[model samples]
Each structure stands twice: as structure tokens, then as C-alpha cells.
Target chain A: MLQVHQVSHSYGGSGWRKSKAAAGKVLDNVSFDLEPGCCLGLLGTSGAGKSTLGKIVLGLQKPASGQVTFEGFELYTKGRQGIRKVRRDLQAVFQDCYSAVNPLMTADHIIGEPLRNYERLSPAELKRRTGELLEQVGLAAEDGSKRPSQFSGGQLQRVNIARAIALKPKLIVLDEPISSLDMVHQTLILDLLSELKDSIGLSYLFITHDIQAVMTICDRVAVMDKGQIVYHTDSPSSLPSAEHEAVQRLVSAVLPQHPSLRTSWV
Target chain B: MTSTHTLEVRGLQVRVNDGGKSLPLLKAIDLTIEKGQVLGLVGESGSGKSITCSAILQLLNRRGLEVEGSVRLNGRQLTKLPNREIRMIRGREIGTIMQNPMNAFTPVYTVGSQFVETLRTHSKLSKMQARAQAAASLAEVGLSEPARVMKSYPHQLSGGMLQRVMIAISMCLQPALVIADEPTTALDSVNQLQVLRQLDKLRTEYGTSILLVSHDLGVIARMADTVAVMKAGEIVEHADVHDLFDRPQHDYTRMLLQARLRGRKDA
Candidate 1:
């Protein structure tokens, strides 16, 4: 389980000068919870701080206010060792899989890095585990020997997911995982996520601007706007009943059947 | 509204040399965009939408690629034209708004300087004349302080603002055709809507035919007069916007339409 309580972060301005931040507040009083084995969709437009929230939760960035706790322990306050343990339980599938992976390293090294760090398996054992992870994410074991450029965008994302799951993380923060992919590829990745979640009992913080993809995969959804969670609801049924105007607009824009729904907002 | 355009493509085929082998990227593609019409090329990545636009401008890399097509603009065969002639036609007769605005502009030059330089290159306009025209164009694209934006560097502006600037630059020449490759893919939804509205306005005011490339079906529905659904380097379906949205013929098109996030509740 993961809990984010009243997290706030701002960019620019520092100390006594008190200048208005050029980029403004990145996050403001954001709070959310993720139960074990349940996917939570963080839906927002670009620049809505969804990724920032993920980073804060993952301990990549220190929040200016509030605390993040996992299973009753303070994530940031526990320091490096605690953070490392937290990271062992959590992993991330970044939006840009190409950049997330080192171009110099082959897929084998990329996937094996986490296993090498967390586990003391021999090189042979590491290779076996890497192959299994690749297979789990719908990639061939032989493909792990190749570089990132040799694979397509969809394949690269699968590799990324494979690496994330190599550590057997309880939660995977997928940031715009399928946005850059094709429709067919997007479907494949979505299906893979669903299958992995069902089998592994994994929780996902599915961050994306596209609502339709989230609707298909996530069990619950939170609509974020301007550094705040404006709406939260259970997926499938509660999405339609949500009161937030922004949520309604996003829902209407993504839906193919409702051409007239967001006309007034536009 | 359906008046025939000067632009025409026939039997277009593009092959890229990958590892010493010619890999077919697009096969025998045929497309036509009438004057003042917006044609949306809807497809996922590697769907040949970008390649088709690049071929029209003769911008694709020649070493690793071969373009075999009859691309005629205003009865002039673009494929037969030399680089110099193509350069002359480009940015003047045919404008382009690339996806990444930051990469499009020079880092050192101010927006004003680049605009003036671009205008001067295509037309014999004095610095003062070019500056005034550039400012006017920026205003037309919905920038509040056109004068201020002209003096600012590309990094000084937001992605949406820079995109508007790029649109402003493209509109300055008032080209016969505008090729926009995922223009609003980098922007927020609000900015995306704003840019789309501006693009629509440009078509109405200047009668500029547009080739809008994107994966978003909703965007195509909102702006395109006609839609071409591309898949695996081929145009699987082509129809009017209303018809394509109402009755997609191909399975892929239908799947795309179905995949679109729908309903107010999901928002």
C-alpha cells in the first residue's frame, strides 16, 4: 500500500528574495492512495504535474511539504536505505523508453541492472531471469542481446516494462506508457499491463492524458488539473457520474460518440 | 467546397535503405488535397504520414531513401524540380509547421530576427517591412503581444506560445499549401484546441490547403474536411470527415473510432 499526504512542491523562487516562480507551483496539496493489487489512473493534460507526483512518490524529488508513506513507514524520512527498500517495492515505466534506457547498454544489461543491484544471483542466473522477464512482457529472449534502437517503439516499451518488473515491484508507475505507440501497439501494451496485473497482483499508477486508454485498464481514476486532484472516482460506472466539469470535458473529448458534448466548453 | 486543388500525388512509393536493403515504407500511395481544404492523415507512428509530407517537400534523405512519385503542385512537378527550385517553392508557395518548434528555431536568434530572416529569404522585403509583416502574422495567430514575442528567444516562450509562433511564421507567406506534422501533439489540450482553432481560421481566411498529420482521431474529426486513415504505410480508408466518423469502412478505422475515449463521465 502507498499513501501520499498533502504533498506540495514549487519550482524557481528561493529563500529571502521571494520572487514569483517563473514556472509556478508544480504540485499543490496533492493526496492519493494506492491499495495493493489495484490500478489507479492519474489522468491529466500535459503540464498537469502527474509525472511530478510520481517522481515525488518514487523519492526522485523531495516535496516541499507533506509526506509519502508505504505500509506505515515514512518514505523520505527513512533516508537512503529506506528509500532503496521502497524502490525495491516500486519501479517506474517512463514515457520515453528510449531515453530511460542507456543507448550504450544492450537490453541484457538494462534489464539485468536492477537484478544485479537487488539480488546476488550469478551471471547465468541473471541472464535466465532477464530472459523470463522479457518473455513475460511479450519479447523474445534473443531480443535482449540487441540495442534499444533495433526495436520499435512498442517493443522498446515492452523492454522497459520488462526491466521494471525484473525486480518484482509491487507498484509500477506507468507514465504515458502508450502515448507514443501506435493503436495496435497501444492495445498490445494495455493488454500486457492487464495480464501482468492479474497474474502478479501488481498495482499501477497509470498516468496519461488519454482517458479512453485509462478507462480500459484502470480500476479507479483521479483527474488532476493545475497541480491538484480535482476529481476521483471508481472506473466503469463512477466516471460518468463524476461532478467535475474538467473531467466531463476530458471524457467528452476522448469519446468518439459525443461530438456535441464539449462544444460549449470549447 | 470541393474545388479541385493544384496538388496531386500518383503512385507514390517510398523505400528506405535499411542495412543495405531497400525496405518499402509507403507503397503506391495516391492522394489529393483540394485548394483551401484540410486533409487529415490519421495514423500511428511509422504509418508513412510524415514520409508522405517529406516527399512532397523533397526533404527526405536521399542516400538511404528512394522516392518514386508524381507530386505536382499548381501543375509543377515537385519531384522533377532541382533543390534550388524546391527551396524557392518551399516556405513561399508551400509552408511547413514542424512538430517541434524549439528545434525549428535557432537558439541564438530572437524570434523576431528569425522571422525577418525567413521572410527576407523567400521574398525581397526590407528589414523594417519584414518585421512589421512578422508582427502582424504573429498577431493573426493569437499571440497577445506580437512585438514582445518577436524580441524573445525560443526558450523564453512556452511550448504553446512557440507553436503559435511557428504557425505565425508559416502563415506569413500565406502559402498555397501548409504541411503540419502533429502540430499540437506537444501541447496541452487547451493549447491544442487553441492551435486547432487558429489552423481552422487560417484555412477560412487565406484559403490555404492543409495536410494535417496526427494519430488523434478526435483532432481529425474536429478539423479535417476529409480524413485518410493510414496503417502500416498504406491508406486503408479515405472519406469525408462526416462519413469517416459516422461510418468507418475499414476494420482498422473502426477500431480507431472505437478506441477513442468517449463519454462525459470519463472526462
Candidate 2:
């Protein structure tokens, strides 16, 4: 379970010192609640401060105001001990799969890096578990020896997901995970996320600009505009009725699946 | 325009010779685009869609790659044209809008300077004339403050803004053909819609032919008159957009359509 209460943030400021010279707030009094074992979709366009919010929730960046409570523990104010306790229970999968992993590291070593830090495992056991994680994400165990350059965009993302679910983390912050992939790969990745959620009881903070992606995997959807949650819906199917300019733009932008259904003059 | 057809490709083939082995990049392909029509090319990555564009543009490295085919633009043979003449034809006769707008522009120069330079290169317009033309072109693309956008550098603008700038440039000359390679893929939803609308406006207003290449079927269905599905360096299916989407002839195309994330669209 996670709760973000009136969290606000702006760039160009460091530490507890708030700079008056800082630009306008990127996130303005944002609040959300994610129930246990349920995915929360944060839908927004570029520069909507979606990633910044993700960083705040991950405790990688400190918010300017308000509180983020994850698993009944405060992320920022409770300091090092609170963060250290929850670090292993939270994981992330980013958009650019190739840049997320080190080029010099092999797949097995990349996935095993977290396990090594969190668990005390021998070399043989670590290798076995790494292989098992790869299999769980629909990748071959033999792929573990290859570098990031060897895999395609979709395959590399699978490796990234493999690493995220390796610890069986309670929540995974997926920031535009399928945006960089093609349609086929997008379907596969969405299906894998859904499967992982049902199998291991995982929760997700799914950040994306895609409405269809949210409809496929998320239980609830929140539409963010200019760093504010302008619309909130219990389900994605009801998104079309929202009157917000941002939501309407997103809805109309989704091109029809078949040419016969196309109404636009293009 | 001198020629009725804007672009025509006949038996176009491309191959790369690595050491002693020759790998085919594009098989013999045939395509044609009339004035004010859109031809959609769709395929997976490494399926020769981009290669086809590069071959048509003569942008591919000529050292090891062999392009064996005829490419005609408005009755002019592009494949046989000298570098000097083809260079003249590139931006003047045939425009291009690539996926990444960042790469299309220089970081140091102001957008106004670049637009003026591109305009002056193809025409005998004076500096002042080109500047006025640039502002009008930017305004045509729906940029609210053309003067501010022109003064700002490429880095200062968002991807959508830069893409609109690119569209303004490509359409300003009223080129016969425009090759748009994933033009809206990098943009957000609203920006993508705006860019697509601008492209459509060009076809309707200026009667420009467009070779729209993308992996997104929805985009193709909305924009293209005819669709071509390519797989493994060859076009497997070429048909009307409606027929291709409703009744696909190829298995690969069918699989791609099926792979699209399907859910309830109505409220």
C-alpha cells in the first residue's frame, strides 16, 4: 500500500533549502493512493512531471512538500532507516531498456547485482536463480551470458523486467515501459506485466502517455496535465466521457483500429 | 508539375557486399505515388522500410551497397542524376521529415536562420524575403508565435514544436514528394494529432504526395490511401487501406493487426 499526500516539487533547488529562484512547480499538490496488489496508472504527456513524481515516490529525489508513505513508512522525513528498509521491496523498469543496464555487464550479472546486494547467495545458487528469473520473463537461460547490445529492444526490456521482479518486490514503478517498443512487443510486455501481477501479487505505478496501455493493465487511471491530476477514473473504459482538454485530446488521438472505422479526413 | 505521377519506383533492389558475401537489403520493389496521395509503408524493425526510403533518396553509403533500380521523381531519374543535380532536387523537389527532429537541426543556430538558409538555397529570394517566408511557413503549421519560435534554438523547443518546424520546412517549398519516416512516433498524443493534421493539410492544400512510413497500423489506416506491408526486405502485401485492414492478404500483416492492444473504445 502507498499514499502520496499533497506532494509538490520543482527543479533547480537542492536539499532542504528551497530556492526562491526555482522555476514554477512541476508537480503541484499532487495526491494519490495505491491499494495493495493493484496497479495505479499515471497518464500524462511529456513534461507533465510524471517521471519526477516517480522519482519522488522511489525516494530518489526529495519532494518540496507533503508526504509519501509506502507500506506505512514515511519515505523522506523518516530518513535513511526508513528508505533502507523499503528499498528492497520497491523496484523500477524504465523506458530506455538499453541505457538502463550497463553495457559492460552481462545479463546474469545485471540481474544478479540486486540479489547480491540484498541476499547472501553462493555463485552457483545465484546463477540458478538468475536463470529462473529470465525464464519467468519469457527469456531463455542462455541469454544470461549475452550483453545488452546482443538483445533487441523488446528482449532487452524483458531482461529489465526480469531484473525488476527478481526480488518479488511489492511495487514496481514502470515509466513508459512499452512506449519504445513496437505493437507486438508492446502486447507481449503488457501481457507479461499482467501475468506477473496476478502470479506474484505485485502492484505497479504505471506511468505512460498511452491510454490503451493503461486500459490493458491498470486497475485505475489518473490523468495528469501540467503536473496536476486533472482527471481520475475507477476504470479506463470510462475515460472517453471525461471533459478535460488533455483527456479529450488523448482520446481523439487514438486512431481507429480499422480503416472503415476512421472518421477523420486524413 | 511536369509529371503527372510524383514518384515512381520500378524493380528497386538494394544489396550490401560484406567481404565475399552479398546480403540483400531490399528485393526488387515497385511503387508509385500520384499527386496528393499517401502511400503507407509498414513493417517491423530491420524489415527494409527505412532502406527503401534511403535507396529512393540515394542516402545509403555507396561504397559496399549496390542499389539496382530506377527511381523517378516527376519524370526525372534520381538514380542516375549526378550528386550536384540530385542535391538540388533533394530539398527543392523532394522533402524529408525524419523521426528525430533533434537530429534534423543544428544545436547552435537559431531556428529562423536555419529556415531562411533552407529557403534561400532553393530559391533566389533575398534575406528579408526569406525571413518573411519563414515566418509565414511557421504560422501555417499552427505555431502561435512564429517570431519567438524562429528566434529560439532547436534545443529550446519541445519535440512536438520542433517536428512542426520540420513540417513547415518540408512543406514550405511545395515539394512534389515528402518522405515522412515515423514523423509522429516521438511525439505525445496531442502533438501527434497536430502533426498528422499538418501533414494532411499539405496533401490537400499543396497537392503533395507523401510516402508515410511507420510501424503503427492505426496511423496508416487513418492517413494512407494505400498500404504496403513489408517483411524481410520485401513487400508482401499492397492494397487499398480499407481492404488491407479489413481483409489482410498476408499472414504477417494479420499478425500485426491482431497484436494491436484491443479494448473497449466507447464510453
Error of 2 at A115 (Å): 1.3
Q: Chain B of model 2: TM-score? A: 0.96
In model 1, where do residues sit more than 4 Å from their true spots? A13-20, A235-241, A248-265, B1-4, B16-23, B231-236, B242-267
Candidate 2 — which pairs collide? none
lDDT of 2 by residue, B200-254 (tens): 9999999999999998887897899998899999999999998987789899998
The most accurate candidate by lDDT is 2
Model 1, residue A135: displacement in angstroms? 1.7
TM-score of chain B of each: 0.95, 0.96
Among all candidates shown, the one with the greatest TM-score: 2
Docking class of 2: medium
Q: What is the DockQ of each candidate?
A: 0.25, 0.60
**Among all windows of ten consecutive residues in candidate 2 chain A, which has the lowest summed lDDT?**
A13-22
Worst 10 residues of 1 chain B by lDDT: B258-267
Candidate 1, residue A113: how far the Cα is off, in Å? 1.4
Candidate 1 RMSD computed on C-alpha atoms after optimal superposition onto the true structure? 3.5
Maximum-DockQ candidate: 2
- iRMS of each prediction: 4.5, 2.7
